[model samples]
Target: MHVLVVDDEPALRQILSAAVGRGGYSVDEAAGVVEARAKLARGDVDVALCDIKMPDGSGIDLVRESRAANIDTAFIMVTAFASVETAVEALRAGAFDYIIKPVRNEEVLNRLAQIAALRGLRQENKALRRQVRERSPVYRFGSPGMLEVERLVRKVAPTTGTVLITGESGTGKGVIARLIHELSDRSERPFLSVNCAAIPEQLMESEFFGHTKGAFTGADRGRKGLLLEADGGALFLDEISELPLPMQTKLLNVIEDKGVRPVGSEQVRNVDVRIIVATNRVLPELVKEGRFREDLFFRLSMFQIEIPPLRERQADMRGLIRFLLLVHGNRNGTALDIDPEAEEVLLAYRWPGNVRELENVIQRACILAEDNYITVADLPSAIAAATSPRPVAGTSADAKSHLRDRLRNFEADILASAIEEAGGDRKLAAQALGISLSSLYRKLDEMGHA
Candidate 1:
């Protein structure tokens, strides 16, 4: 690992640098915040030891700057006086650890090693989670609201009760259903998912329950249905509400009996498979209107989970964005940064399409971003348009308030436009706007767009 030592005392800096170098790392020395910032700009430093007091600026400023840049560099604050308030402030500013000024070489080395180990574990866990997510056929969620969904998944995954997942189109209801199956004891068994909406009413039964060789016009040969294929595992019925009334009745019987009757076969085939249903529409409303079977609705909704829209949990947007960028970056062999201005625009706009939309946006931005950073101009035109505000009909109390509102909107629009233009290259966009990247990121985070 490469370490940077920032201190006003040249002698102290040399001592710290020598100790860190002896601990198996390259060392860089900085006189103060200005020099530290310059070294950071050059990049590749993994950790920094900064003195609390400096001639130009406090070390807290350096800590804050490092965090804002989204740098993974760990920080250790060194102070002559370790007061409660100073330590608290240093930690709050994002320092990894704090040490007294008369730090022993052994103590410093030990803390550095600990931080390295912890950071390694965190990276490993992240990689493992990413692997699991990618391997799962259906299991997609990167929003805070989905945390509840995950909890419920864990609770019901081991159970035999039927599960009904409800969410908007493209909101990943299918993914949740698959996760439940994968988490269950029958994970090794065959898992099949059928989209009820895609099958025609005439073929729904045959598709789900199978048909005999001479059952229908197209039943020239015997074939196994999804339920039979999913024996000992899970059968996921997506868009369950789209199933016709007759099919719904047949499904209800199959679930209750744990067996299947082929279209023309007299033989009854017993199968033990977990059933999971997902729909975007409300089944209760359908049942009340006599469009769906009430008994079937009751049977399928034994375990119900409602996935909320992305707008409700905007706090997770940044984490999700970061995750997606890493995903795409790994795939394309490129790294990307999110411009603060563009991030603000993203957070401000209500995502009607939810997580799916956010993923799509990020994917596009990744492709479009020419530089290391993703700016607002890289966003889709629709998002840019939505984020830009127009003049309100009502008047404000004062010109300042009116100007403030207008300026806010104007800033949002500029950020959005810049990101769109930069193809979501935040660093490049920040440079274009003539502001420090850290400042841009901070501004965007404050606007809830990061």
Candidate 2:
């Protein structure tokens, strides 16, 4: 932890700094509010210990300024005044804790620990808020397949092994990668992501390793590579299969050596980086076909997670659609409702493009929809095309069979609509459907949709 000590008294500042440093934290000193503000502007201070009365300004003012700037640094006010009124005022002004002057070393350490815990709580709360805001009811799934996948993610996320996530396009691989990072110890560090398929092959190396000034025609200043930028953090290599063979070798070397040598620089810089790779390709086949290196595949696949396709988890469809409706509605600042008949048709249709396709359909439906609720007519031509086929008419036994088949189709259509709206992930789809993963899976199997 980095600590800033702010006090007007030279002796007090030095004594407190030494004590803080001894407590396994780096210390920066500021004699007054002006110096403190300058130090804060540089953006490295994590916790600030300030005197209530400074020569230039009050510590309360500094706390208020820090809060106004949206800095996450924790503040503690140290002063001769220890009255309840003074403490309350400081707390209201954003001081994390109030400490009396002539401070004991043990007391200071205890208060610092409390501040650290509070900071952690605040960070967790922020993360939870972001999750809630970004989340829609659409990703819920009650299938056994989804439960197993969740269990695997929980097991593998905390390990040091490299993870390779594979799935069909738009199957929420990116979300899974983020969940792994969020669950890991490196959650506090930077989580850098690069889509290999998006960047041109020529610029791939430079983008990953960075380039020193004068290294290339356009090079003006030394640039820190993304690998270096993600030092002591995670580097998410999305669509890793898109990388050319030559660049793959270099990336493999970096992963193995735990360092990188920037372009035009002979000096090697060590890095502490965790890699999480995602791809939509069949990597084993690619390796056999000689398109990908077998060694590199082994290095990346220390832990492999294969996300099931939407069709395989059809029971999650209904919840997914509702989730998507809410998401699109919230994003567009409009309210949308889905008719049961339209939703049933949605569940019956197969989502060839997976979750991405579902989101596109919902967005389209929302824009075209004239009423509060979305009807079958509001759905896209492609979705209607896939869902309009009818069963043949027959006799008594056949009639019972046909009726059962029709009911199953209706259920499938509802599930598909939910999944589409939820954005194709089972967990969110299940939540939107208000069912468990096991029940969703059972429904899918019964309908021959899984």
Candidate 3:
């Protein structure tokens, strides 16, 4: 990291320069704000450790000037004269942080390390998006349920409304999202996706709206948030129900105004993009519990699409399996054949993890196949054990029990499999089973597993 030290005091300059230099940073020394601005123009500086008391101008003034010119340098003010008012003013003028003089060199070094991590994350995000743009994914679905979904995608592709996709997890929510983007007029533009459940809640808002250099902790430079990066394109926010209530409001405002305001900055940038959001859980139930904002939910679901679970649409399973066979077959550099018995087992089992689990199983079977033929034993133990359920000694379940009782027992089996598939995460199991946590708990207790 290149750290610039701008202090008018010769003694302080020598001390900070040597200490920070030895701390493994490329250090540049500037006597005043004027020299600091000149060094900043060189554009090699990652952070500027500037003193408030400078000969030419206050460090705050330099911060304002550098930011106004878009220098992209993180600024930290170091001053012996520190006050609540001064600190607030420095931050308002866009300094990343303030340190009271009698300064601990350790604090300075720690702050620099944080700035380095932020820069690293920024570069990583950029590289990931670039990689996505270089090559995109293609999804083909032959089931009637998915064909209906494809029709809906075609119908909505020309419109400007927000799309809300609801389904069980791993039912190809991401695939539907990508299809919506690829069929739209913005097909040639950037397509960015953010998994809300995967990101830390504290950083969620900033990741969506972006932030300027020195806007907040560790914000070493400016960044274009996902919404802006998808300008003139599509931004697919998967697991949208996982978004915090506060962020849901912000996202609603962006959808309403077609703009985004970066964190800690007054400027609101207009963006022309389509918003496609997906969630495995039901949003209305969350709103009823006061966990999600109702207004935002209404706005986002303007064009709603509901996807059926894999078991509910078994007709599509064969086509999907064939597609997977081709993909994993090519990946392993061999032609894979599935015997009749293995195919029967696959069709009989309830896929709690949906298509994703199917892909994983296929990949594993491809690796384990002998003579390019996948056998029943090659399947995951959980799936391989579920070959086919036999009736209780020729007794008809319907003849012996009430319809509701039979369904209750049937649902119990599904819950058990989903729980095992999720490795005992009740939350994930609930998502896989298309039920709420409370519902899952109640069912588990009813089944004598509590």
Candidate 4:
């Protein structure tokens, strides 16, 4: 906690500031009411140990003005008068605790400790409420690129290293960030995820570094920004390239110094948070264009992981489709199935929107499906057009042959995709496809590929 010792007496101010500093808290001193008010107005002072009577003005008056301004600093009024009226006036003026003249260092330390505990509890409560939100299951990857990304995540999760994940939009960068947080020693701590592009440029600093109540217009109450709120945890900053130049410098400072000074505040507060940033845009290119800082890019790229787009990982497509189907089925309380033709269309699409688009497509299909069955007509027009021609309903022998050929070809593709995902290991492929080894071999043999 940061403490401000306010008193006109030079000796008392020095003595208290030294004592508070020795007690392991950052301490600043102000002489008289004007100086104290100036220091307090900054909103950095956590607790102000102020003298009741000063040459310029009364501490009670200062406290009343601070309260009216909504500055949330805790005030501990000190006075030599020791009268009930003085104590009552201090408390009414928003003083946290009162101290008589000739203060004992021990008593002051105790009061400060109490205030620290109260602050901890308030922060804890906020974190707890945030933790109550449900988390979705993280999908495991089968492609070599994703496997390597997973390996990096595991290797760095146990440490305090900052992570920079580069991927296309909707490619699950946020999911990777959460996986690292959940695997880390600080998993129990809060994990905050914020989209840099979503926040207004004007509010970026205040949102990231917190602000004192009344620090700006509409700031009715104090806020402990994302860094403080994610203390001892992880903060995922998605679309990091959207951060303004000024905020970028502040973020780099937090990375190097592990501290943040709130807007309108003069003092810095220590924070311990593991930052994980993600961006689709090439940061180095931005630096070349004079849009991003080179120093910040270097710092963030110290440990980087790039996620491959979904189109480049065809082997994982079938697995992802099945997983999404199962998830949506469980959520909507419906047993959903997709037609082979529809599944073929999905597998063939370029998926320009990546995993996020695939998920949306699946969800929409599930909702549109009749009798819990998703067919080609249920899919989006662009996706449905990606596949080969579908068989027409007919009783002719040629039509029967064409339909059988199409179904056989679809099955072969599914098996090939699964085998590819398993790295040509048939046993693993069979297990992934939930089929027996004998059945897999028999099918492969019948397909004349063995």
Best by TM-score: 4
lDDT by residue (193-226, candidate 4, tens digit) is 8999999999999999988757899876667789
Instruction: Write candidate 3's Cα lDDT for 240-359 as tens digits.
Output: 989988888888899888777777655455667799999999899999999999999899889999988888878877877777888776645666888765776688778988888888
Can you rank all candidates by lDDT, best first? 4, 3, 2, 1
TM-score of each: 0.57, 0.59, 0.60, 0.71
Cα distance off (Å), candidate 1, residue 332: 4.3
Alpha carbon lDDT at 121, candidate 4: 68
Per-residue alpha-carbon lDDT of model 2 for 1-450, expressed as tens digits? Answer: 457899999999999999987886667789999998876654445689999988799999899998887665788899998789888989998888888989888888888878756655654565456556664333656767676778888898888679999999998887888778778888876567789999988777778887655677876545657786666567889999988999989988998987677676554556677899999999999999999999999999988999898878776787788888887855356679987767876777778788888888888878655546675646765576577444557655554443235555667898999888988887788788776676577567655777
Q: Write the per-residue lDDT of candidate 1 for residues 270-327, one digit (tens) a residue.
A: 6677999998898889988999999999998888999887777766777777777887
Give candidate 3 regions above 4 Å deviation: 1-139, 331-333, 390-450
For each candidate, C-alpha RMSD in Å? 28.3, 13.4, 16.4, 11.3
How high a TM-score does candidate 4 get?
Answer: 0.71
- Score each candidate by Cα lDDT: 0.77, 0.78, 0.79, 0.85
Report, for all candidates in order, the number of backbone clashes.
22, 42, 0, 0
Q: What is the lDDT of residue 304 in candidate 2?
A: 92
Candidate 4 backbone clash number: 0
Error of 2 at 33 (Å): 33
> Between which residue pairs do clashes occur in model 3?
none
What C-alpha lDDT does candidate 3 achieve relative to the native structure?
0.79
